[model samples]
Target: MAMTAAPPRVVATEAALALIARLLARHGPLMFHQSGGCCDGSSPMCYARGELLLGEQDVYLGDIGGQPFHIGAAQYEYWKHTQIIIDAVPGRGGMFSLEGPEGMRFHSRSRLFDDAEWAALVAQQPACFQADQKL
Candidate 1:
């Protein structure tokens, strides 16, 4: 298989990581999950610490505001092309959002998964995830 790459060319500000550390410290544990949301149903999501790297996944588990936040291998792969970064703002605010190097903005939303993600999850753990009753 071809080697997957790292996330986009975006970097986080020191202030952001600092704020995240504070948030995680207060929340304890967290959960980063994904679900079908768009035409492809392909969304990348990560939250608390866990062992779920399925690819060249760059899983980062650290203190985000005192709580643990995780980014799996899947995200690392996609990050290579998106130029996405999680940063801090002037005030306490939302969990996480994506931004580009050109100063573009992409807000976080509910999970969006394509068929591939679902298949991968099912392949990895058949017992997990509910069957698509709509099918």
Candidate 2:
């Protein structure tokens, strides 16, 4: 039997990708995390690569706009069955996120995965989750 590839846990809109490219050009490299912190109200937070530390308690949701995205394991538990849609909007994001001063913000929209999608995701092996990633 042939197994189908799981759908990405996270995806970004064209505008988000464009902003990411611009940020990358300015920042050299980047990463993203959403910890439901106070300032952003759960919005995706962008950071320069190595600016933040990733712990085993963080769940790697996957990449968005060619950069890795993650969330606290507790948050992941709440979001595990959903698909995260990343978008760029005009506003101030988290104070610490790289996008705060760019006149744009990275936002996260999510919807629960359908049964088929969930099944496919669950069928995948351990490779899907990144642990203890540096930078």
Residue 89 of model 2 has an lDDT of 93
Worst 10 residues of 1 by lDDT: 97-106
* Predicted candidate 2 versus true structure: per-residue lDDT over 1-135, tens digit per residue: 655567899999998999999999999889999866686678888889989999999888888878999899889777887889999999887878888888999888998877667767876746555342211
lDDT, model 2, position 11:
95
Residue 99 C-alpha lDDT in model 2: 87
For model 2, what is the C-alpha lDDT against the true structure? 0.84
The alpha-carbon lDDT assigned to residue 116 of candidate 2 equals: 68
Winning candidate number (TM-score): 2
- Stretches of candidate 2 off by over 4 Å are 1-4, 126-135
